[model samples]
Target: MHITVEFGGGAELLFDNKKSHDVTLPEKDKEWIIKDLLIWIKDNLLKERPELFLQDESVRPGILVLINDADWELMDTVNYVIQENDRILFISTLHGG
Candidate 1:
């Protein structure tokens, strides 16, 4: 399935400073959850400093995630199942003054 991933608030820096990425997940029997997507991102898309983009299994604290422009927390957070063409955005809340 195809999905769009967006990064903002310095999150893009971890990904070649690009803000948007077009990603494809394999077609498999299991559903694709946000947690699994994170792993895929770390393995496939993350260009450098993975520690900045990942923590254990999910995004580190202070990073916000959105699904189809809605806060992912309202849609089951990391447990949310991803749909094709879904627009996912990651924004880091931490910034130096």
Candidate 2:
């Protein structure tokens, strides 16, 4: 199954490579999703920019995740059921001093 992941302040990434239909995700990745939504952020957002992983946080400062035009926060975050052709968007959250 192919899914499109959009990165906040970044570009859209496509993951067409699937090893299995019932592939269980890593425990660490699962935890990250619940706590800070890192897994979804990393999997979707960081493709060309591998340097982002080196940082302490999995989700960058400005990153905001949206699954199928709805914010992940409103949905199930990482546990959200990713269906075929589901559109995931990432955008930067505006912060003013």
Candidate 3:
């Protein structure tokens, strides 16, 4: 399946400073979920300081996840199933002062 993954609010720094990624997930025997996407990103996209982006297999606190413009919390967070053309956005609320 194909999707768009975006990072913002300094989160893109962890991904080589790029803000958007067009990803084509490999076909899996089971449906892909946000949890699986996180792993995929860690393996394929994340360039540094993973600890700042993820915690316990999920996005760390202060990060907001939106799926297709809706809050991921409303879509079951990491359990939300990925679909074709879905847009996933990760924005960090943590900013160094």
Please give the clash total of every predicted structure, in order.
Answer: 0, 0, 0
User: Where is model 2 more than 4 Å wrong at Cα?
Assistant: 8-58, 94-97
Off by over 4 Å in 3: none
Candidate 1: residue pairs that collide: none
**Of candidates 3 and 2, the better by lDDT:** 3
Model 1 TM-score relative to the real fold: 0.95
> Positional deviation of 38 in candidate 1, in angstroms?
0.2
The candidate that achieves the highest TM-score relative to the unseen native structure: 3
List the candidates ranked by TM-score, beginning with the highest.
3, 1, 2
- Root-mean-square deviation (CA) per prediction: 0.9, 7.8, 0.8
**Which digits, one per residue and each the tens of the lDDT, describe model 2 over residues 43-89?**
64344554433245434545576777887778766566665456666
Predicted structure 2, TM vs. truth: 0.46
Global lDDT scores for all candidate models: 0.92, 0.47, 0.96
Query: Which candidate, 1 or 2, has the higher TM-score?
Result: 1
Q: What is the lDDT of residue 17 in candidate 3?
A: 93
Candidates in order, TM-scores: namely: 0.95, 0.46, 0.97
Q: In model 1, where do residues sit more than 4 Å from their true spots?
A: none
